[model samples]
Target: MTARTDGGAAAEPSSGTGRSSSVRRTGRWQGVAAVALLAVAIGVLAKRPPLLLVGAVAGAYTAYPRLTATSDPDLSVRREIDPASPADGERVSVRTTITNEGDAPIADVRIVDGVPAMLSVSDGSPRCATSLLPGGEATISYELRARPGRHVFQPVTALCRDASGSVEVETSIAAASAFECEAAVPDVPLRAPSGHHPGPLVTDEGGEGLEFHSVEEYQRGDPASRIDWRRYARTGELTSMTFRTERLAEVVVCVDARPESYRAADATEPHAVALAADAAGRIGDALFDANHRVGLAGFGRRVCVLPTRGGRDHAGRFHRRLATDPAFGLNPPEPARAAEREGGGAPPRSVTGDGRNGDGADADGTVSIDAQLSRIRAEIGADTQVVLISPLCDDEASRIAQRFESGGTAVTVVSPDVTTAETAGGRLARLERSHRLSGLRNAGVPVVDWTPDQPLGAAMTAIGGRSR
Candidate 1:
């Protein structure tokens, strides 16, 4: 949470006393001069009364009000943001209400609402300028370019000045409020699976997966078709068919949220790590809706690994994890010797650890990319498909994809390529990006090169089509 206080002016008693003393001293001197002039004028007025009148005018000017003005603008602002689920690049409206609870009327009131770094102002402005009377209320509305994850709002400022203009005061509203707007994940409808588990799992009843595994003596309410005619003929008794138990596929989505991979090429932009997390959430939701088990794992500075489970509760868990995870830079760990052995294109040497180095042994230090992929593969069944979401910035990610393929687990990569040829800084950066793209393609990994400048779904579809 971020807070700031500004714009209240306090009058020092010593300073005020000193100023009053000076004024009093000057007034006494002027009074003495006026008395002297008045005495001289009284003597001269014996001959002329006009001079005595001038002395009285001067004395009246000295006795006029010596007014000192000071204003204190005490403002309090509270904001409540709603509709916490907004999609990437989507427009979200933020409503801010300002109340003047102070005694002074605030003039030239300008407010700056703190927006999330990931969000951009694509349409309306976040700053507002207005005037508020005491006990009056003002409302401001603006649109923000929503990005995935939680964002905090900053405090509102109030500027007020006194009527005399001699004193000016700026005050920040106390009791500031904050609300989080979670960006929604984009999802594509999933195709229904062919099999099911019979005990409490959702499925299309009477399907091919429901096979008759046993038969028992027929009882009341048994369907005629379920009756075993052969058993009835042999034993002269009616029997009912029992179906086999059905089970749904359990899916676990493991996302790479390490600091190195989290940062975008343009540091000002939304991090790729957040994008990958959004995609994972979308996929997880789709699977959950289909009655398939879904799980989430975020590997970064602090690993947030969740166990695989099914139902609406699990989906909520996954969403919460994705919304609060911290963003990391795009550096991945070094590749293993096995990655080199199973060759495709030469891996780039630019990739390195995110400041903190990982030990060669998986248990001794942080889990390397290879070990994580292996662990994920081992946890799921052979038929389970592992959807790896990453920016593909390093050799380790490619190696993991290859390992998953070789391990008989179907691997589909959703690569969010933050690199752009239009503004790659220099020729060297552009060349490096080209080489990385080539290497990823050579590995036969289904790569989705998503750019911040374009729509993610369209880019992924284009890549998916070309791969086919």
Candidate 2:
């Protein structure tokens, strides 16, 4: 059975087709009755038979709308997608065929296929308008470029109007449509220290690894491969080479879904919260591939925390939650606020014992960062590093990062560049964002300044070099 996704509960298919229909009055012919009355009055006052005929014609037109009967439009929608499992950044072509199953002819019909929000249309249109007779069909084709993550198509909307255009039957056609694309590991460098696990993170402690750390006098049972043969030959004594110890790390990929991070550089682009959520999924996948324990969290009006775990199953569940969970869904927490820095010139709030800044909330309903951080600390291990994805649009976001770092939690801030310079306010916000990032870096926190236009891997690589 085809699945329904209309921002509500799935509709059960009836008559072997998933369709739900509703009717509404368009009010297109409401003023025609008044015109007919006026014409009849003119004919009576002027005593002209021609005016009377005009009144009769107006009356007929007015009655035509009321006389026209439109049945519930029964539509069967079938969607065909080319290259069903598309690679990231691959263009996908979709064709939707809509068939009218009702006995009455639909004079005017409009159909709009559901397109996933994360996938942008690269070519063609998903909408079509035409007339459909009994058993007649219409088709619409569109192309969308795929991105990382699983995307589900919403239900198609079809509007059928009667011949008089006075009534409209709106139908939502459901079809099974969804695709999952795995994202490549970003290979983001971790400046934070690692947990005690054998993996790829290099540490100062000498152990098994390719990169040399130091050499010491050879001890009994030292691996022959690690023995410094040249040093032994020169000094007539044995020495052993010690390479940097590589251990895996437990990482929590946290996204800032607060209302302030919902800003987008332009209307066409996804908001910062959406971009951050996507980045968090990629980072979490990377850590998981390296056999490191990965946890997920979102800090905002509603905080969502998943405890640290390592495995393919955990990664799959983590990625799916990021895509479908209400806390991390594409929808913003609140209306997009102006991308201005936080108001009230005050030093960043320190981590208080009670996990509240003064009273835990402000008069404006803004929750204290300390409370949120406290929740995170309670769930994570002491060695767990936090990969914070935020827009850094407001000072409070920076404060959250700094607080996490100061509280002895390893924190890496990934700030997506969502500030545009199209207006004076945008320019000022961009300047302020720059200073905030710089301040975070100076405070000894590793910061990745990411622009949505650039590949995330490239940004991570750049920041990795800088941190090294």
Candidate 3:
């Protein structure tokens, strides 16, 4: 019923007592002895043969514990999980094997595999019980479903028992099984500013800048400070001065975080959505640092938008939204809220009617296909450049990218290839993905083909920032 500390006894050397680790009495011995004594007393009073036989068995069973030595059994445990780095919702098979390495025979051994907390046993159990002799090995196999993030499988719980149920020795076994589920997002690629929305690019035809552009005929209301007074004194003609325009690009970094995007090539790899999300944050950070106004828009079962702004604080806010925006995170919308987001009468979880506000349909859940495109257009205004980060798993991404470009908004597609050619279906899927990207390129959308494992900058550098 309760565990008592062994104090000095636990620390004592095993050689003197012919025992190993300190053991605990399971307390079942006391209950068995009481029952045995009662049966024997009843048998003696009634002189019944059946009762006497039952009492004899009970008494022998009671003696079994006393006959066995209370010592820790010598055992070694090893655990292995196939496909260690499982993607979200993927299943991984795990096997835990324990060996009786010592000469003593273990009557009963229970071994429990340490499954990660973020993972659930989808197919088999985490524990198994068995008996083993010297050199005998018992293996337990199970399957677990993975989620996002890294999870370390805790140490295995091993319990050893002797012939008698009185003594128990407990220990833990750790075989270094760590399962990391999320995809790696190391760097993001960005197109240097050209002619966009106004950050740092100096335009030729400009006015009101620090650097001198050119002198022009002075108008009646020209500012005296801007007038070329030296030229006027030399040639006696009043002329105004002009300077280059620092035009910054209005940029919208779009990330695809749909449930479909949360897929990995197999159980032992990261998912596409994780990669996309990481890239989105990095790109947003870079653009913000470059003094370009950057906004974030997430497309999934729900749409999330954070208005465009240029500052370190806005970068932090973008990172936070990427971390906690429920539309793109593990937690789905609550029921009432989900209803409001999805209901027609309620607002769509799409971009707000006024995209510049950056408060898109205010957590509107998933919208219809047309509504999605409409929201995307609304989120990106005219002359704004859009960088879409996706895995290109579906053709719809290609179509959307092209649609934006055709609508006078320059669209750049940065797709991280997540498909593998391991199987026929995977090969076909990869080919289809290539075709879709090719179609986008043909449609004049600059496609930045990238692999998730590689540095994003390398891929962009290969293209030398040329999107069209």
Scored by lDDT, the top model is 2
Model 3 scores a TM of 0.49
Query: Against the hidden reference, what TM-scores do the models get?
Result: 0.49, 0.73, 0.49
Candidates sorted by lDDT, best first: 2, 3, 1
Global lDDT of each candidate: 0.53, 0.75, 0.65
Among residues 3 or more apart in sequence or in different chains, the pairs in candidate 2 whose N, CA or C atoms overlap within 3 Å are none
Runs of candidate 2 exceeding 4 Å displacement: 1-70, 148-150, 160-171, 180-182, 205-208, 215-241, 260-269, 332-373, 418-436, 466-468
1 or 2: which has the higher TM-score? Answer: 2
lDDT, candidate 1, residue 130?
Answer: 74
Query: Model 2 Cα displacement at 415 (Å)?
Result: 3.5
lDDT of 1 by residue, 206-225 (tens): 32236545666678987887
Candidate 3 on 389-411: residue-level lDDT in tens? 87888877777787777777777
Error of 3 at 435 (Å): 1.4
Model 3, residue 285: displacement in angstroms?
1.1
| Residue 464 in model 2: lDDT | 84
